[model samples]
Target: MRARLDAESRAAGFVSTGVCRPDAVPDIAAHLSTFVDAGRHGQMAWMAERMAWRGDPAALWPEARSVVMLAHSYAPQHDPLSDLDRREQGAISVYAQGRDYHDVVKKALKRVARWMVAEAGCEVKVFVDTAPVMEKPLAQAAGLGWQGKHTNLLSRKFGNWVFLGAIFTTLELEVDAPEAEHCGSCRKCLDICPTDAFPAPFQLDARRCISYLTIEHRGPVDADLRPALGNRIYGCDDCLAVCPWNKFAVEASDMRYHGPHRAPDLADLAQLDDAGFRARFSGSPIKRIGRDRMVRNVCYAIGNSGAAHLKPVVQDLCEDDDATVADAARWAVERL
Candidate 1:
């Protein structure tokens, strides 16, 4: 059954798979409590909500005896760091450059789960970073990969770029051996951080993280962090790109996730109104940030660009209806 499960999952586009008991990570509850108590999650109150289910997968669904953790590859063909040097263009994270991974990965997870139901007669539920599931620790516990010093999954075979999804099942599947951390004094992911988001070897302060600042954060970012943002208008990927294990990453078979949004011109992005923003990113994950936040981020990027020629582009937005957008525009003009 396990071998057949692997074959079906691979056929459904999963790059890797592992099974583990729901309580595989006994320390997860404590680890989560510590992070939340410290407020490192910043504005993400959802992380604080449903603490019990987030802390313990077993408690989430007591009938589930095993968790089938899966990894769907989205590795970039080109080095994402190279996009940073395109100062006049916005550097979207490699993950966001393509279609939304949530939609893609969840669809694939459902397919795998459906097959398991038919073949093994097990009841299952699927989650793709949806709900309160903390997938990275569970992935490590299922032998998918270890949570590296950067606090993100780092797979030896697929690197740090795989999207994680979970399958909760009632079957008593044999569990895989948990993977151990292999960071080994490597500081590449740590040293390359533009915002110094990591306070320790295996911890992240999301408040100072650029990805959090650009995406999850609402309103004006700390003035101090704006310059470091450079042209990364959406999510940031510095830590993931710098991981040593990325050398082994295989290219994603799904072309929808590779090169659609690479480095769009900052000037072009700065002109988007609410309707334009919706239309442009209609099917993409970038749409979630909305026009106001996206334009605000673009203003910051333009300010860091030092491309004085683009001043007129943001100058038109100096009195945007959204106060945050207007403030960021004024800030950009001053910087230029």
Candidate 2:
């Protein structure tokens, strides 16, 4: 059953697959409590809201006997950090460069889940990031990879550029041995962070993280932190890009995830109204930030770019309906 499920997962485009008991993540609850108690999750209050479900998968679904974890690689074809030098362009994270992974990975998860139900005659539930499940620890427990010092899963086969999805089933499948940590003495992921978001190895302070500030964070970002944002207008991938394990990373198999969307021109992005923003990032994950938040991030990038040519573009947004956007535009104009 385990072998068949693995084969089905690979046939469905997932690059990695493994199984573990639903109760495999023994230390997750304690680790999560420590992280959240330290206020590391920042404004992601949702993490604190569903304490039981997020901390324990068994608690989430008691009927589940096993959890099958799957990983889909979305590694960049070129250097993910190369766009930081193009100050005039806005650096969007590699993950959001194409169609939203939730939609893509969810569809793939459903396909695999349906197959599991059909082949094994077992009940199943699929989850792809949106759920309260702690996928990293489950993935680690399932031998997909160890959670690296950056706190993201890194596999010898696929590195840190993979999207995780899971299938919980009533079938008692054999579990795989968990992957051991291979980070050794490497601190490259920790050192590369512009805002020093990591308090120590394998921990993150999301409030200072560029990805959180630009995406999940609401309202005005700290003026001091804004300068360090550089040209990254969306999510930041500094830690992921600098990881030594990425040497083994493969190019994304999904063609939709490849392209110039990796670095869009700040000028063009700054001019986007609500409708234009929706149309531009229609199927992309960047759309989730909405126009105001997206433009706010662009303004921060414009300010950091030091490109005088974009001053007028920022000025035009000075009176944006969203206070955050307006504040960001004013800040950009002052900086430019």
Model 2 per-residue lDDT at 279: 93
Q: Candidate 1, which segments miss by more than 4 Å at Cα?
A: none
Best by TM-score: 1
Give the lowest summed-lDDT range of ten residues in model 2: 251-260
Score residue 58 of candidate 2 by CA lDDT.
98
Clashing residue pairs found in predicted model 1? none
Tell me which residue pairs clash in candidate 2. none
lDDT of 1 at 69: 96
Task: In angstroms, give how far residue 144 of model 2 lies from its true place.
Answer: 0.5
Q: Compared with the true structure, what per-residue lDDT tens digits does model 2 show for residues 256-275?
A: 77744788899999899999
